[model samples]
Target: MTQSVLDKAFRDVVIANRILANEGVVDAYGHVSVRHPLDPTRYLLSRSRAPELVERGDVIEFDLEGKPIGGDTRPPYLERFIHGAIYEARPEVQAVVHAHAEAVLPFTVSTTPLRPVVHMASFIGARIPVWDIRDSFGDTNLLVVNMAQGRDLARGLGAERVVLMRGHGFAAAARSLPEAIRMSVYLPLNARVLTEAMRLGEVKALSRGEIEAHASMKPDDPAMWRAWEYWAVRAGCGDLLTARP
Candidate 1:
């Protein structure tokens, strides 16, 4: 069968994920997914492969039920449940990105929460809750592979743009793969700024009102996409911005 639109979208996500991975923002542990085109009950994401090295043919397809539908792949991400459950709960979300960016990884292992010390993180506001999977399972490395845990994480995220997985990593969502990538890149930058500010002493979070004000201050600027396009071209994936699956 010819590659479907859903497969193409998955390829785009894989490309962006690889770019971040090559930059060391995301390594072997993270995953990215896009909602299926014709089937809202399905999604497209990379299977068990190094995110930085993923190619178009490496993408996989799966339904909400977690059954693999595409690729001659072996197995999918163990935490595929996260993608399935999030899409199940939030119809407005079209893409999801989970990465262990260096700046955010430290906070995930610490007792303190990631306060919104910068404007970027302020999009979610205050302290983003760290979902402690270690507490849920006996081991910190246990993957959230079931619907029950997935739904719990979804509830913690609610309508927010990101969720911190305690002792693990974090997840970010957006309307498209590129937009989701923007959130992933921005989130770590926000966390790094907050962490450094904490070391320097007293850091104040942007108030909810201030965040709203900032939103009105700049509506969907092209700076990020432009930057991504530049780097993507250098990384040899410039065509991804317009390529279908």
Candidate 2:
């Protein structure tokens, strides 16, 4: 990739981390990543650090095996495998986000399914799938630290845009960085809304037609740009918007 493309990718990754952190989708633990603009075999993720504290310099390039390129000695997140496995399994996905948002955690362990209760979160589809690590690993720390565990999580995600990790968080895959960030932000909001709606009566999620229409939103859509700009500013990364490709 050209310097401009690489710069833009790194900038967006930093902005994404900040946005997610500021929005409460992630705090000190979660991460966001983007596929390399010029090489699908590689992706970029921040070194082990708080999302809100991530900067462009913290971004590191990793191959599909989740090994950092250039022999960078910085500590990487144990769950970096989540991003690599998703990118490896889904070629069309340009970005991935993993977070342990509190609002969405209950749904992961409960029988209640996290469905889209608001129009903005229609991308969540009708029912969100939950992946319990114990099903395969059988009693562990429940982190996707290896490719095998990551692959199992990716398989749980399948063709869906998001998958909940039981007792952990969720992994979101999108066609672009903006969309991935948007999905990660809205997933928790949708869960909170669903939780509230359940107390009133049986929750009525978006219809198939509504989901099909809203989920069709493209990364370049003006509405998506508006949300991105708003969140970037809220995260004190508004200046990064100009650097976006």
Model 1 Cα lDDT, one tens digit per residue, 158-244: 877788987678887677666677667778888888788888998887887877664442222565466557657766777766532
Q: Which ranges in model 2 have alpha carbons more than 4 Å from their true place?
A: 243-245
Best of the candidates, TM-score: 2
Clashing residue pairs for model 1: 8-245
Q: lDDT (CA) for every model shown? A: 0.73, 0.92
State how far residue 26 of model 1 sits from its true place (Å).
1.0
Clashes of each: 1, 0
- Which one wins on lDDT? 2
Segments in model 1 whose C-alpha atoms lie over 4 Å from true places: 1-8, 70-73, 124-127, 134-140, 214-224, 243-245
Error of 1 at 117 (Å): 2.5
Worst 10 residues of 1 by lDDT: 214-223
